[model samples]
Target: MSTTVEKIKNIEDEMAKTQKNKATSFHLGQLKAKLAKLKRELLAGPTGSGGGSGGAGFDVARTGVASVGFIGFPSVGKSTLLNKLTGTHSEAADYEFTTLTTVPGVIMYKGAKIQMLDLPGIIEGAKDGKGRGKQVIAVARTCNLIFIVLDVNKPLAHKRIIEKELEGFGIRINKAPPNIVFKKKEKGGVNITNTVPLTHLDNDEIRAVMGEYRITSADIAFRCDATVDDLIDILEAPSRRYIPVVYVLNKIDSISIEELDILSRIPNAVPISSENNWNLDELLEVMWQKLNLVRVYTKPKGRLPDYEQPVVLRSSGCTVEDFCNQIHKSLVEDFKVAVVYGQSVKHQPQQVGLSHVLMDEDVITILKR
Candidate 1:
């Protein structure tokens, strides 16, 4: 176990010392592929004694429509945020290592129940199997959103370190999957195509990465300008998760208005004071948007729409049929058509088929044959 980690560290050290250029592109690509494989193995736990987190993962039986994981160093007020947002009790203190395991909470926002988990504190070398970092980040990989809680007094380096930790674990925060497409072929040799000129990737780099992965035959198409890292991410897509993240700058009451204004300038950042309960509403609003959850009201025939508990659905697969499936699996079998009376419809009450995609807050009334 220690030897694998040592190999990873050595490869990373070599990668850092080597400069990137036309001459070193192939070597760098190989090193990156090697590093990725070693890290994957470390997490896989070949010992079969439960790798990464040791026993079982800290993951709970997930509830609610979406889950948000809170990750930060100890005493960054993550537990406080979890308590305030979810009204679930999580032991909070000014000291480090206060929150040991995953403490779950539930946030009722905009008719959607979002689960929030206060994960164990993360250290600088957590990604490299330092501390309980693997366990903490393993749970984070399953979250729909992540709250990277930061102390207002902490240096910007803390934020960078946490980001690197997540990056190493194949968590791409606040990013979409790369536009590059990869396809496997049996007979044809590797064929590459790019619609746009790639500035950060060369032929050698691409070939080197694929070769290291033992991908001898594949069709590669790049829709946008891509880099070697982007190609690597594409290849590591199975292990990767593209999740939305919000930088939660806590203890904002200790900072002045001038400092608050400057902190707010950071992209996708929300400043809040969990103790003082300052700016929590704004934080919730931002969380709702980032979650991208759709709140759909189910209106029974000849009755008002039930606005209390919406049939919440994710934005990616929120069609009339999907909505019906959420209510009951048999609803689809008994389906005829749907009457949508919201942003998804043209008239006050327009009849839509099961394939019609629903927008947020859309009122849906399914009719059975």
Candidate 2:
């Protein structure tokens, strides 16, 4: 029996050879679905390897309100940057693969504790279980932000390779979930409704992808011009994570001014020299923006809001209830109402209930019943 990787390659080869048209749409869709499933299996750990997410030694205790993982090819200054940023040492060296395991550190920025992880170097085929790449990327998946460290002297194409490896492992960097809604029913046949014109995919291809997942009865709605792969991604929603990523182009000191200018133009990329500590502050600023954390200041009953120590929450779950729960387990149940003052509220110091959404720099004082 061929291995998962081999099977995937065969499907890919077939896909490359098969032309996309009305006649081959179904075949191509099936190939894409099969390719995606096989890739998932490969990332789940090649057949009989016990299918673990990562190595025992690589899993470190996550700290702070947010975490950032450093991933790159060998000797890309990940350790040096981590040491400089967080004042923690991780045994940096000139040779490749100097860092063998995950090194954890912390940085307190603007009163928010952010965890930094220095991971080992990963080579090509890392997604295929080559040289701890999967383990390194597995750590990255849990990070609130990812720093794709690259040596300024190396080929720029390395960025694309690293991104491909991450994507193969189901990490969608700086991407939102597709605007496709799906529901399954007992007996209704697969019905696809499109609010917009279906430009990237047609009904035949959609049906083919749905068929691969063995979905006979479902209601599918598309609000965007999504491709067949996007539909497959929605089907594989449990395995997908849409996370933010910031590309850290390391070793800028080795390059000239012109090169630095060109590097700076890349979207979502920040260039810095970990060795000289150049542009690190800018990198941190970009990281802060990408994390999108909301800080809520607690105001005592009759006093002012606490500015020294504010509760940091992710923007995705920032709400009055989430704020109370972050404070104490019973704060929500003991809550009668909350007085809020900030951009999240319209009036000054308005009384809001548990479900009220909170925003950054919002001041809140709770009254218990």
Candidate 3:
């Protein structure tokens, strides 16, 4: 796969060199994005391993490497948020439609990696092929989560306009609802009560609003399971082609305490100040929890070996002896016994036959002597 990708890149580079006049900056950018996406797919595993199939599918085995899609209306601080999250320093401007294309970056969170993609802003009538909304939605379908950024200053009706557009595209993302982030000046500290109106409501009203959105206190507990299966059920339906979603409330530094309080009432709505760089770590932690990833380590005991080295094997109740056979016919022929080291003391360093059932992350030392 690496060779194929390299060859494709070489071909593109050669074409760019030969057809200088034909290749535009936009074309080059598209090529670069394709190359990057391909590299990511290869690292994640075979394509369509997650849920969906074809170009719209995601890689499930690579759920530990989460990807969040930043989506919202024009000038909703999507680009700024991406820059803040990944430190990519992408171009950010105050004008509408500053980002004409989708940009991707990697953000490291607590030793885990998450990919953040800044998608093109959506406009009204996007579902019917208006503006760049359709293209943006296509890009978003490839992500594991979507952070719908909304300006709190806008009226409720205007906010609904964005939601309508998303719904028009037949994208059913209920897990991570659109986060209402109030973007304003950076002078005053984030005042939840003053800046966010939702904070002014009593706990009962807050719960009511969450209930209307299908978000309840139980959802928080449900999210704690920290497994891909849980995340999948939360974001996408039981269908074979659904991805997870996460809500992010960005630009909290601009809001008043009262308004911020109201915003805080929403479940799983993260507050972040892109300008001041506040709560980014907390946001990442929330995303990690939402991903529900399980870590498995493999120590080679020697050199790390190449990238293609297989540390884990997919099996069907095969024993250690069978695994040795799979690794090489000669290893099975010379297989004497297997030493296991894990679980209780009785099982520690125990020499067992090839029929031993391997538990998750069990350390097995095969003996040929």
Candidate 4:
């Protein structure tokens, strides 16, 4: 029996040979959908493995408001950088694959306890179960932020390989989910609406994805110029995660100043010498910015707002209702109204309800019924 990886390879080979045109669009869409399903199956693990975590023996207890996972080829100073950033000793050495498990650490920055994970090094074919790469990447998918560590001495093409590994596992780095809204109906026979002209996909391609998923009745609305893969992603949304990634260029001290200047131009990259602890502060700043956390301060009815400790919330989950729920589940039930004072509201502090969206650094006072 061919393994899931083998099956995926065969499909990829077929896709490479198939040319893309009007005649082949439907076939290409079918192939892409099949490839997505196969990859999900591969990530789901083999039969009877009893799926729990990504892989056995490395899933650690999660902590802090957000987690950052490190991924790189062997010996790219991931452990050294982790130790320097978090003061947690994760066996650092000059050899490859020195750290074999998920090493967890915590660093308090800007009143937020951020968890940092030092994952094992992955090779070229890591996505296909090479040297615990699948497990490492799996752990990384759950993290709020990912630091792709790279050795300055190595070829920059290594970055693309790591990206491909993550992409094959359905991890979209530094990307937002496609603006395609999907809904299922009991009797509708595949209705599609688009606000903007789709340059990359047509109704036939979208229908091909929906047909492959056996979704005979549904409504899909495309808001952006999305491709067939984007439509398939929405159909297989459970298997995908839109994650933020920061490229950490390690060991800058090994290269000359001219070489360093060239490496700095890479987008979303932070050049640092992990061994020498250079530019560590900037990395933390970039990390905090990418995390996009909202820190809401609670102000008592007649007292000043508490700035020392904050009720930190993810930007996506920082609504007034979410804030109340975070404080206490029953608080929302007993709430009369919430008075907000900050940039979220205009002019003055206004009375808002549970549905009000809270912004970062917003101050709020809840009045009970």
Q: Tell me the RMSD of model 4 versus the true structure.
A: 2.0
Give me the runs in candidate 3 sitting further than 4 Å from their true place. 1-64, 155-159, 175-241, 301-369
Candidate no. 1 TM-score? 0.95
Please write out the lDDT profile of model 1 over residues 43-147, one tens digit for every residue: 766664223342354858789999999999999999988888778899999899999889888878888888898999999988778898988998898899999
Runs off by more than 4 Å, candidate 1: 47-57
Best candidate (score: TM-score): 2
Q: Which runs in model 2 stand beyond 4 Å of their true positions?
A: 46-52
Q: Is candidate 1 or candidate 2 better by TM-score?
A: 2
Tens digits of per-residue lDDT for model 4 on 1-369? 998889999999999999888888888888899889888887778663312366665799888889999989889999999999999999999888899899999999888888999999988887777778778888888899999999887748989999999988788988899998999999969888899999999777776777888889988888999998888888878878899999999999999999999999999999999899899999999998999998899999999999998888976557899999888989999999999988889857999989989888889999999
Alpha carbon lDDT at 7, candidate 3: 52
Candidate 4 structure, TM-score to reference: 0.94
Ranking by TM-score: 2, 1, 4, 3
Candidate 4 lDDT score at position 59: 93
